[model samples]
Target: MGKTLSGKVVVVTGGSRGLGREMVLAFAAAGADVVIASRKIEACAALAAEVRDQTGQRALAAQCNVGDWAQCGALVEAAYEEFGRVDVLVNNAGMSLLYPSLDQVSEAMFDKVIATNLKGTFRLSALIGARMAAAGGGSIINISSVEAVQPEPMAVPYAAAKAAVESLTVGLARTYGPAVRVNTIRCGPFDTDIAKSWPPQVREFMAGHTVLGRIGDPGDIVGAALFLASEASAFCTGSTLAIDGGFQ
Candidate 1:
C-alpha cells in the first residue's frame, strides 16, 4: 500500500492516540500528507513530527473538539488552509462515559455522548464531503462501534449515537455520491487504550465471544482502512465493514 495515496491529503480526527494514531501513522506511511487533529494540540503535534520525520510526509497538527460544531468548522478550515485539498477524511473521534446505571445517565452525559459521537461526524462529513464532491472525488470513513448493533445497557447512550452514525453514513453517501464516497467501519472489541480499562472478566468474555477467540490488535484495522481510503474500494459506499473478529 506504500505510495497508494501519494499526493493526496488525509485528515483524521482524534489522531493523537489509540486507533486514530495508528491510522495517522499508516496513512503517512502510504504517502499521504496528513492532518492530525485532537483535543490536545501537544499530542497532535508530537504525532505530526513523527509522521514528518519517519515517513517524510507533510503533517499538520490541529486542536479540535469535534463535539463542538464551531470547532469542527475550524478544523475543516485549518486542514484546507494547510493542504488546499482533502482527499480522505476519517471521522474517528468518539467517547463513551461510564455511568452507574441506565437510570443514572445524566443529561450532560447523554448530550456529550451524542455530540461527540454523532453530531461531530455529521458536521465534519457534511463540510468536508461537500468540498470533496465539488473537487471531483474523495473518501469519507466514519468509525462506528459494534455496540450500535449489539447494545449493552452500560453504554446505551454511546450505542445510540453510533447507531445514528451508521444511518448518517447512508444519508451522506447519497448526498455526496458519484464523487465523494462515504462509508462506515463498525468496529468490535479492539485492544486500544480504552480496552486497557476493561475488567479482566469483561476482557475474557469479549475474547471468548469473538470467533477469532481474541480482541483485535490496533494493526488489525490497517488493511481495511487502507483499502477504503484507496481505489481498492472504489465501488464501495454507504456500507459498513465489520472488523470485529467475527463477533457473534
Candidate 2:
C-alpha cells in the first residue's frame, strides 16, 4: 500500500477509536496525511500521536462534535489547514442503543440516535462534498451497517439511520458524478466498543449470523476504504460494499 495515497489528505470522523481509528492508520499507511476527529480531545490527540509514530505520516487530531454544524465546519477547516487539501472523507462517527423492540424505544433516544448517526453524516457529507467538488474530485466513504438491511427487532432507529446513509451515498454519487465519488460500506458486526456495549445475548446472536461465526475486527474494513480511496475504485460510485461476512 506504499504511496497509493501518497501526498493525499484524508479526514476520518470518530477516528479516535474503533473502525474510525483503524481507517486513520490505514490511510496513513497508504501515505495520506490524515486528520482524526472526535468529541474526545485527548483520545484524538493520543491517536494522532500513535499514527504519526507508527506510520511516520502527518496526522492531526481535532476535537469535533459532529452533531453540531459549526463544529463540523471547523472539522473540515482543520483538515484543510493541516494538509491544504482533502482527497478523501470518511464519515464514520455514529451511535446506537438496543432494546427489545420498537415499542421499547423512547423519543429522546430516537432523536439522539438520529442526530448523531444521520444528521452528522449528512452535515459532514455536505461540507466535504462541496470541497471535493471544488477541488475537481475526491472520494467520500460513508460507513453504514448491516442492520440497515437486516433490520433486527432491537435496532429500529439505528437501522433507519443507516438505511438513510445508504440512500445518501447513492444520491450524492448521482449528484457529484465524475467529479467526486460517493460510496458506502454496510459494515456487519465488528469487535469494537459498539459491539462490546451490546447485551451479551445480542452479541452471541450476531456472532452466529456471520458465516465466519465470529465478529469482525476493525481492520477488516481497511481494504474497502483503501480501494475506494485509491484509483482502484475510480469507476466505482453509488455502490454499497457489504462487509458483512455473508451475514445476509
Candidate 3:
C-alpha cells in the first residue's frame, strides 16, 4: 500500500461498514489519521478500534446524523478537536429509496431520500469547504452512484438524489476554488448490503449488468478514494471518477 496520505487527517461519514468501512481502512493504510462517523456510535467505535489496531494511527468515532446540519457541524468540530485539522472530507453517508415509479413514490419517501443523500452532502461540504478555505486548502470526495447517470427507472428517487450529489461536487469546486478541491466517485453495482436488500432475482440480474460480469467488492472503491484523498489528485477537481465496471 502507498502512503500517499501520510500525516493527513480525514473525516469519513458513515464509516461503520460497507463502502464507508472500507474507506476508513484504506485511508488508515495510506497513513492518515481518520475520523469515522455513523448513526450507530457502537459500530463506528468498533471500526475506529480496528483502524487503530491495524494501522496504529489516530482514529476517532463520532455519532452523526448527516441530514442534520447541527450534527454535521459538530462532527467537523469534533474531528478538528481530535486531529487538530482535517485535510480530507469524504461525504460517504447516503441512502436509497426505491419505488416502482416517481408517480408511485410518496412525498415523504421522496423527501427522505433527498434529505439524506442530496441535502446531507451539501450541508457537510459547505461546512468543510469553509473550514478548508480558512485553513488554506483541502480535498472533498463525494460518493455518488452510476445509477445517477444510467437511471434506474424504478429507483427514481435514488437516481435523482445521486445526480444532485454530482451537481453539488462541481458546484462546490467552482464556488470554493483555490482553497478546496471537490470531486465525486460514481460506483456501479456492488455486492454490499445495500444491493442485497433488493429482490433475489433483481440482485442476480444486477450481477450481470456490469461488463466485468460480477458485482464489485468494497475493496474496489478504496484505490480511487485514496488517490482522490492524496496529492495524486492535486490537479483533479470538479470531476466525477466513475468506478463503474464499464457500465457507462
TM-score of each candidate structure, all chains considered together? 0.99, 0.95, 0.96
Compose the digit string of candidate 1's lDDT tens values, residues 1-248. Answer: 56899999999999999899999999999999999999999999999999999999999999999999999999999999998999999999999999899999889999999999999999999999999999999999999999999999888999999999999999999999999999999999999999999999999999998999999998888888899999999999999999999988
* RMSD of every prediction: 0.7, 1.4, 1.3
Query: In model 3, which range of ten residues has the least summed lDDT?
Result: 96-105
Cα-lDDT of candidate 1:
0.95
Structure candidate 1, residue pairs in collision: none
lDDT of 2 by residue, 76-189 (tens): 888887788999999999988866768878898898899888888888888889888988999999999998988877688999999999999999998877899999999999
Candidate 1 Cα deviation (angstroms), residue 126? 0.6
Q: Which pairs clash in the backbone of model 3?
A: none
Clashes of 1: 0
Q: Ten-residue segment with the worst summed lDDT in candidate 1?
A: 1-10
Report the Cα lDDT for residue 69, model 2. 84
**TM-score (C-alpha, index-matched) for candidate 1:** 0.99
Q: Would you list the C-alpha lDDT of every candidate in the order shown?
A: 0.95, 0.90, 0.89
C-alpha displacement of 178 in model 3, angstroms?
Answer: 1.7
Clashes of 3: 0
> Could you give the candidate ranking by TM-score, starting with the highest?
1, 3, 2
